[model samples]
Target: MKEITMPQTVRGVVAMAKGAPVTLENIVIPDPGPGEAVVAVQACGVCHTDLHYREGGINDEYPFLLGHEAAGVVESVGEGVTDVAPGDYVILNWRAVCGSCRACERGRPWYCFATHNATQKMTLEDGTELSPALGIGAFADKTLVAAGQCTKVDPAASPAAAGLLGCGVMAGLGAAINTGNVGRGDSVAVIGCGGVGAAAVAGARLAGAAKIIAIDLDPRKLEWATDLGATHTIDASTTDVVEAVQALTGGFGADVVIDAVGRPETWKQAFYARDLAGTVVLVGVPTPDMTLELPLIDVFGRGGSLKSSWYGDCLPSRDFPMLIDLYLQGRLDLDAFVTETIGIDGVEAAFARMHDGDVLRSVVTL
Candidate 1:
């Protein structure tokens, strides 16, 4: 592998501190060093995690470069990099699996504990070190990441749409297809019809689920869920979620219940809303302060699998290209996830829209 010869300076969105506004600042990106790559980001999506980082929900890492879901063209690759090259169109993924990790040795590379990022750092113009969000800070003109973080995809695909596969969309789709293993004719219920939940509905439909139920407090989200293949919709604001789900499933509950709203209430709803022996997949992320409590007997009596999906249990190398193909073939509507596209400076506004459920995703186009 050879290191790229040129380093460049670019503008990027930076969260200078917790609870402060993110600003556009000049960033100095160093040439790709061993096993790294430099990507000229075409588009990147604003995700809740980025907001979380900004709000200090993730960590105290200040002056953080925020944005992860992105698609870009590789500008150069560093020494020992063979998987991708300059000019290759790729989606950036946070998990860069290390084959030597224990999980990888067991053939579950998606659970790799030793994921890698660029050995080098992108710095503020004044030489302050910057933490790249999720190891793939992409809300910028260009970003540096591990070579393995760049998953090659069809260049013809819309960057705004394809970039989403790098995170939230992929997580939602994987929660249904990978973690839940939704099968044809299965009845599925998804609580919280946000981006991830809506994607779960689409994934369940793609997997041939017979009854796809979407539950959300917002009517608009339910509508989005319907467009994404939900056969039934339940407005939690006006209805009993578990009861509505059971009613839709002939009083037996669904075959699989996905809780995409990580909360004690929603988790309880999902736990009780699944039929006996039905699976419960928790794909929504919870804050550290959150805790769940259930009857010990209920846990044993359920006799079903309770699982948590990390990034939808997705193997980006296998899922990205396949999903891209589906999108290109008109089978998957990836474009539906992109509600708007904005310039890098609009990330803060996008964050507000995301919080208000005004958009599924607001992509930053470079």
Candidate 2:
């Protein structure tokens, strides 16, 4: 049995107010309660979602404890928790699906309506309650999360790389393989060559896409897409994106078009940049004020599916370990995503670099 102990103090990044910069402050993590576990986080990726949380894009949850994409080792487990035990290497995920939820009951836990988080809350040293980002705040030495949130993976896998499977990478891969249902020899086009976009390209490759077209405004990101298995690239800034995609696919466009940009204009391009009956997957995060005014006639004329991917429509327990195995087997280049690694203190600057389109990921190593 795992021995329970007193609350522990650790420093974590916090966003105190909307649009304000983040700061490192001492946080008090209580022992895991029923069905919860404590993790000694090894590495956590800095995702744009964290930036959004800091900017008040997700919600008005103030003094938010940021950081989610993470890999760690189980340090303790609470009463009745049995999925993971001490010393287990694990990836932390937000979707700790409740087994009896509607989606779970329907055998589609991926769309779980009721996900679990730590039953107990971690707070500032001053005792102010903190809302953890995505329920697995991990930009610290330790974090408390629901036991189901931790998916055991290959201990040999690099925590920095395996941790990526927790969020953006999984979302992108799941967007292509799970949501988009990309099949062998399919022609695919992905817009926006950011972390999610690049991962989408990799997913397309892993799904055996014969001709992958990557579209982005930045030359650097386009180059990244090419390296990630895109067979062709389109400079959306200087080209008619839809026309270019059509030309690449014998004037019929790709079979699957992914909009990782999440903007109205890019989404419109994806809508028209696919063949009739083709699919369009939107994996990008869009602002609330953003709106799309599309012709109703086109919806009837297009004759295809338009879907938005949340967390890539993924099931962490099913996907994380398998992806990590692929990574360890040299089939998936998870390392390609880690552009740089930094200390916890380097997060703010890393955010700037991410905003500037400088890197795919900056991992925070403890």
Candidate 3:
């Protein structure tokens, strides 16, 4: 017989109502059962996804527990959990692919149809179930997740920088290196130069892109993209995005164009911004109500790949530690993405800054 661990109470941020502000409340976390683990979250980045949850842009699920991009230490593990153990420094990832899924069995775990999350519920003190954002509610003192969601990374890395890779950063990097298949001397262009777009630019540079063109309406974000590795920038607010990209690429457009904004307009821009047979990778997150319509003839005329990147099609088990190593070696500038650090209570103000595009990432340090 095994001893049953009592439920522990911790402070967490919750969106109690749609279109309402998030509140700090007490929540109860159950003992990890069978394949779950509890993580004492050290640093959780305030991502745009968390803001979407508050605005009900993701779904109608209210009282949502937010925060996902995170890094922490494994505090405890449930029985039969062998992937990670206590005292291990880890980065929390939402994709915990089940081996039995068709996608996983096809040797494509990145597109795993079935992902695992904690079976046990982490509820409010009143016993109301709180839906965790992306199945990871790290905006708390602690969080419970399926053991597979915990990806162990180099402990020497800064939690604030390493945590961003848990989501946005990974999405951008994978968009270029994985989905886009950016090759040496390729001309790459990334649209919407926010955190994700900037990361895509860096990823392109890392992959030996000859020309990295960044397009965005905001000069601040464009400047950030330049710092990250963009060799050229297009101010979409004034200049024609497609024309500028073509001009930068010797009038042929880029070899690969990535849209990190996730809007129909930006996607269309990406669609038309690439050279013949070039690839377009849509890494940005689009809202539910948004619809995209393109001419059927144009779809055929454009002889290239149009793909959507979910979490940059990343496998945390493989990418996390390797990227962390690159960061430690100074080959990858993970630290540049972090704009500021704040306490958990400062999330709302951080959200305001994120809304105004005043910050890249306002990390919540526990």
All candidates' TM-scores? Answer: 0.99, 0.99, 0.98
Clashes of 1: 3
Error of 3 at 11 (Å): 0.9
Which sections of candidate 1 miss by over 4 Å? Answer: 1-4
lDDT of each: 0.94, 0.94, 0.93
Supply the TM-score for candidate 3.
0.98
Backbone clash total for model 2 is 0
Considering only N, C-alpha and C atoms within 3 Å, which residue pairs clash in candidate 2? Answer: none
Native-referenced Cα lDDT, model 1: 0.94
Candidate 2 lDDT over 78-195, as tens digits, reads 9999889999999999999999988999999999999999989999999999999999999999999999999999999998998998999999999999999999999999999899
TM-score of candidate 2 versus the correct structure, residues matched by position: 0.99
Q: Which wins on lDDT, candidate 1 or candidate 3?
A: 1
